[model samples]
Target: MIEEARIKKNLKQFTFPRLSGTDYEIKAYKKLTKEVENLNLKYKVQFFTFSSFYSRIYPKIGFSSVSIILFLFYLNIHMSISIILILILFTILIISIILTRKPEKIQFITKMDSQNVLVKIKSLSKEKKNYDRIALFISHLDSKGQRFTIKIRIRIFKLWITSSISLTATIISKNSILRGFELIFYIIGLFPLIFNLLSTIMMLLNTTDNSSDGAVDNASGIACNLELLNHYSIPENRLIIIYGFFLLELKNAEQWVLDIFIII
Candidate 1:
């Protein structure tokens, strides 16, 4: 039976932010593990430690740097060779940043350990071959915070999108006059760049100051994953079901889920 009341009760146990690689994150992981045990299921906790830079810090630095680069690109149309050299460096910096942002890429200097709880359900049929296929379900347990309110976030996204277009226009535009005109979008983008600066600062802040309890951000997702598992049973010799609760979903630092899938 999938008891909504029980799920709600469990969620209440951890109402604070679960920052990636933080103590609170481990507590939540333990709590969830306890629940899995209560259900009389077999599970394993894969403890793996990985160290990386504060995820938000570098990305924010990257964003602010790119924003400056865009502004510089617009302003340096007729600048000297020295200015051009600086622009080249900034461009290379941006490229390097983009490479490091993905989940699979490990470019940070600091490493931290994260846990993934794996629950496996096997088919009960006499023949193991009867259940040939495997189904996997995943959910992340962590939350994040940002500087701008929801309202401002929309405007920020719009600004970012417009900035991309503006940058593209300037890059491809052959005429100086037209390129100058396209620079307006980039100018408008400056407003969000200011917001980006605020975001960068917020990113560097600890989860206590910058992260939220994240009820809607990801609590609901975890709850749903729990509920779905509770509501169903694995058939014997017909299916194998695996449930993985991955830690550290904040700031794009988690790729442990992918690694888990490969292991499965």
Candidate 2:
């Protein structure tokens, strides 16, 4: 049955990391559209833009800051011990703020062709008065795979623990010296967040295929969608299934979704 086919197609669509603008994503969209059309369902193929998951800005910033800090530390100025301590304390505070300001990952979006994409989709159902709105099936189509070496993983974990401890110290320590140290720790903690953001940006710009077929990352998700369509009989209500391929390097999901709808 057509319903069965839709379910199968959904499965395929979700079987890979559907990074925005990737070949796999494009192909999957095309296949989904064709299947929907075959079922005599009126559908639209919307496009959107999102931040790339492999940006390099954050990492670059972290490394650059570290280098600068090291260079400054090496230039042993003739300051009194008290002055040196004060400087270190200030530096720690700055570092903490920087870390806290690091942007979030998974902040990409699809561009829709219209400012009122949601409205348009809603209209489709509204025009067919017989069709009631049933459920909104939302799923993201993307894949994330990190080829972290053992050394890198260990280093990352260590840094993460250190960052957490430093943050806790900052919160709990009342002594001015401890507070200063906490500030520095906070800044250092930000390095990882920045690095991640930069990597995400890079991913958006590159054609690198980091995933191995993205089977579990997303193919499984698509498969699940298809299965749902197949198993569930057509309801009197309209089904709104959203296949989203977002850039995972950004920080705002709601904003990204709004942007996608605007493009649609």
Candidate 3:
């Protein structure tokens, strides 16, 4: 039985801020293991490390690239030279993005250790070998905090994207109507550059921390997964269930787990 009281209790137990690589996160992982132990289920812990450099640097790269391309449009240089510069900038951006995705291939940042908890529940049926399917439930175990709220960040990002598109359209379009209105469009484009530049500066200023209670963001999710674990543990259930309490901030960790599952 998945009791609401038990679920709420679990939620309350996990509501505290527990940022990855921190002592509080270790405490939360301990509590999670204890809960699974109470159910008498065997589980495994998989540990891994990741760097935050890519997450922090990618947005700045995108913003700077856009700003520079827009600035190029106003320069009095030869058209061929301007095109060559833009192509070079784009090539650099593409390479940076590819390199950052595989951060281990480059060695410029600090790596932080984290772990994921995995539990496998066997099927009750004697014909389990015939059933090759497994059910997987996943919930992340880390909480993040930043200076700006998610809503504010989303709005700023939307505005930046929309303005960038508009500016690019104005710069490239050759329609007579648009050409007649080019002066107005250029003037309008300046505001977004200024505004988005400030937004980018604000984004750079914001730092990750551990201050939020994380009740809604992930405590509730963890609670629900616990309840599901309780429900699916019954001998009457026929399908195997795998519960994964992952550290999603580290994408490679999740991929490694999936690879293991595939090999199984």
Candidate 4:
């Protein structure tokens, strides 16, 4: 059974910013390992390196691509130029998607080391070796602080995208009524550019800090995982349960790579 008291205790202990690739995060990992050991639960620690380049470059790419696309529209440039820009944008998007799927392919610049803690439990069935299924309980242990909260950032980005799309639609529409208001649409389109430019600048100036404790995002998750580990550690449990404490979900100083655990 999951105990609220135990969850609260764990949450209290872990309620602080533990940014990835930093000493605090390492310390938190150590403490978590200690807790698992105290529970007499076997666990594995996975250490791996990752680059923050993907995370940092995304905003810049969005800003630049949008800027160029709008500029081409504003100038009513040659179709050849517009096509080339579109092709370039498509290529970049494809490459970025590929890179996101395969972090190992990323170059070593801004590389940082982080770890995950995993606890795997096997079924106690007579045919233990042939356990039917595996279960996973995952949580992230790190937190990040930024100039703007996620909500604010999301809203700003959405506004920018919506304005850009509206402008593009209005400018390119065949309807005579829409075409007559091209200048007004263009002016409205500029609002998103201002937002995009400011966002890009903010991203560039962003620095890692320990302001957010991340209780909800998520010490609560860790606490729940811990309780699950405690409950499933018994030999009588019928299913295989793997509890994983990952480095993080948010990008702090560097990215935290997952799926790199070594069973002990």
Highest TM-score: give the candidate number. 3
lDDT rank order: 3, 4, 1, 2
* lDDT, candidates in the order shown: 0.61, 0.43, 0.75, 0.70
Q: What lDDT is reached at residue 199 by model 4?
A: 54
Model 4, range 1-264, lDDT digits (tens) per residue?
778899999998888888777888887888799889988878877777767666566556766676567656655678898889878987887777777776645765588788878777777776745554456677888877776778977776676576566656655652345777766766765665565556555545555566888899888888888877888887765366677788645223122223323221
In model 4, which runs have C-alpha deviations exceeding 4 angstroms? 77-94, 127-130, 174-208, 248-264
State in Å the error of residue 204, model 1: 8.8
Model 3 segments more than 4 A misplaced: 75-88, 100-107, 128-130, 173-185, 253-264
For lDDT, candidate 2 versus 4, the one ahead is 4
TM-score of each: 0.70, 0.46, 0.83, 0.78
lDDT of 1 by residue, 74-132 (tens): 44556686487567768767666676655445645766667778787775665755455
Q: What's the distance in Å from true for residue 166, model 1? A: 3.8
Model 1: residues >4 Å from true position, as ranges?
A: 50-54, 77-110, 126-130, 167-210, 231-238, 249-264
- Output the worst ten-in-a-row residue range by lDDT, candidate 2: 112-121
